[model samples]
Target: MPHFFSHNFLLLAGLCCLLPGPQNTGASDLNKKRESTQCQNFAPTITNISLFLLQKAIHWPEHTNLVFSPVSIIAAFAMLSLGTKGNTHKQILNGMGFDLMKMPETKIHKCFQHLIHTFLQPNHQLHMTIGSSLFVHKNLKVESKFKKAAMELYNSETIPINFKDIQAAKTQINKHVMKGSYGHVLKVVGDLPIDTVLALVNFISFDGVQIGEFEAERLDKLEFQLDTGKVVTVPMVKRQGKFYLLKDNTLSSWVLMQPYVGNIMAFFILPDVGKMEELIQNLSHECLNSIHKRIKTRSSNLSFPKFTISTTYDLKKVMNTLGITQIFSNRADFSKAIRDEHVKLSKAMHKAVLGVEDKQWEELDFPDLHKNLLPDGPSVEFNRSFLVILKDITFNLPFLMGKIKDPKTK
Candidate 1:
């Protein structure tokens, strides 16, 4: 059955992208005037946090697929940190892969601003949206300093709501997040907890077409073995083209990379039998860099399963695990960001969705054997009518995954 494109699929399944037509104008160009030079050096810090968060999330059951944008999460925290002071500020920055004492806070905020403007704003190619909101009860007073920073720097919309009306507050926040993410994240605030005075929510949604799409005729049903040894049939796509490939004998894995329309790169890591667990266990920032440096581009037939996955994170727990405790505690100092002394961070929520597919460029066509000629030793000569069966390369089970986003214009 052909998958239908709809918002529900985007929110629940996190796959099956709706390719934007030539006239799609939803993306805005408000930030195009400013040069994004600051984000060049700043991107690595955000990327570091993404890797850290992914490593922590990898503990999920091996059988389950995972997807989240560290850029969205970091943008949310950066917006929150604009109002923090003393240890609270330092702790948040530290967890974000920065040295608060050495790095000026203003510089950090400016870099975040650059990142938001660079990625969130509309472009001719990538379809993406990132936004944040601060919900506070009407009774509490918010500091003008923090409010101005949030609006000007993060492009976030700060709304004052009555948190006392729990149901109303939830509905309002959910609606705002849905619009912010363009319907990718359905619910942001589930239930307002008792004594909750303030909530910070951030959302990111992205849908991009493959640079080369796989042919619908080549889609085949194949078996996928889960980590638990359960084999399931799934739709797999095939393409024979030149792509960046790396065989890491040291890690006993082969890495294949595919390009998306924008600057996104999907990496598929297939580990040798029984080595999947070990490869995942040893996955780290340094190891990834090492593997990236050794990759070589080559022509080969690639077959991969077409699947979709979505994930929601309770960022408070993830932050605490990363040594960001003061902000979520009573001791948190928000004197600079809020007028009310009693208000502290009560909830932090983030949701992300990603979709991937294959594209077949003209280069992917089966080579003409006679025109290209062949080696002499025991090699069979081929003509236009010669049929050559290719080996099947499948990604069924025990794999590691990573995505790199580098946005560019068409």
Candidate 2:
């Protein structure tokens, strides 16, 4: 089993009250409009794909925290589906929650194209970058339609590489993944087969400062209870804000949502104690939609432990389990993508990293608290006493320790 490390930024605050501000309010309204417009008619499809992936991931042992971009994964598959033929194409579309017979091919492609274009729009407050690439072996000649769809619809670049040079090819692909993820992902492509004719790679990176940033001075070390009954100490942050909250009795869980600076928002679904398995078993699109509808804005006092987490998965098995088998088999047909030789997908891999840091401390250096907290002597002048100097700082018990970053800088 693969060991999974925490790669998600655990926001100290869960759901908080939306503060009143004309500028912020206007921005929020615009974001709402953009999101609604972008996801129209495609929301159900997106949610189904995302939920299926999440359900498969939840079964992975030792991974308590999970972070993978469903959009990135599905977009990669959608691009690949364009190159498939007959049943191979139908299977791919079906896995994506679309019936090829009912949905016109052009409409599906257009929806994905629009979604990608909208997601790539520049946002100063939140940084989200998505990249996709089609690496073909030098010997293979890609078809014009295939290349055009990849380049025009998915905005993916085509890189011609000599697969015989396995080391060089691996290094090149790994470097691209690293650069695409802004160094958060060190590697993705591992050992490449000698017959590797083509590789499809996708990357998604997200970084954003909390709108209601955490106070560095208020960070407290406290005990955190893990699902395994292990009590560990960790750095915790706290804040009070208006947040949408819902008590999901049917699912026996609680759902909380908090917005970021842009259209992106994070929803956390926490299961009731000892009911985690039930919650995971009950995961569905209907449950999520109901939670969204039931949630209402209210003042909430939230505190949470933070973590930076990374997860990697060999999706070949997962894809096969999802009934997308022919693509990886010897009988695979890719006549639309390439005509030079018989080539089939040999591997599918993905790696994602999530980092959350307190904005206040992430961009600042640790101060000399020992010297700053102490006075020159007990007889020091009262006018310039340590007590007066200490008034600005706060200290807590040495409970747990972890890395802290100043959030002021990117």
Best-fitting candidate, measured by TM-score?
A: 2
Measured against the true structure, the TM-scores of the candidates, in listed sequence, are: 0.73, 0.74
**Candidate 2 ranges with C-alpha deviation above 4 Å:** 1-39, 58-64, 179-185, 209-217, 361-410
Per-residue alpha-carbon lDDT of candidate 2 for residues 206-324, written as tens digits (9 for 90 to 100): 55424233222244556655555665666554444445656679877656554544355555555666665676667665665566567886544445544555555666665765788
Give the alpha carbon lDDT tens digit for every residue of 1-410 in model 1. 42321110001111112233233333334453333443344545655565556667655433244555555566677777787888888888887887656557777788667656654433422544455677766766688878888998988766887767778888988898666555656666666775566766655444443422322224456665555565566655544445566777876766665553323444566666667656655655456556556776665455555544454555677677678877776677777766645445655554444454445422244544412312321211110010000000110101112321110100
Model 1: lowest-lDDT 10 consecutive positions: 383-392
What lDDT does candidate 1 reach at residue 237? 52
Model 2 worst lDDT run, 10 consecutive residues: 385-394
The per-model lDDT (C-alpha) reads 0.53, 0.54
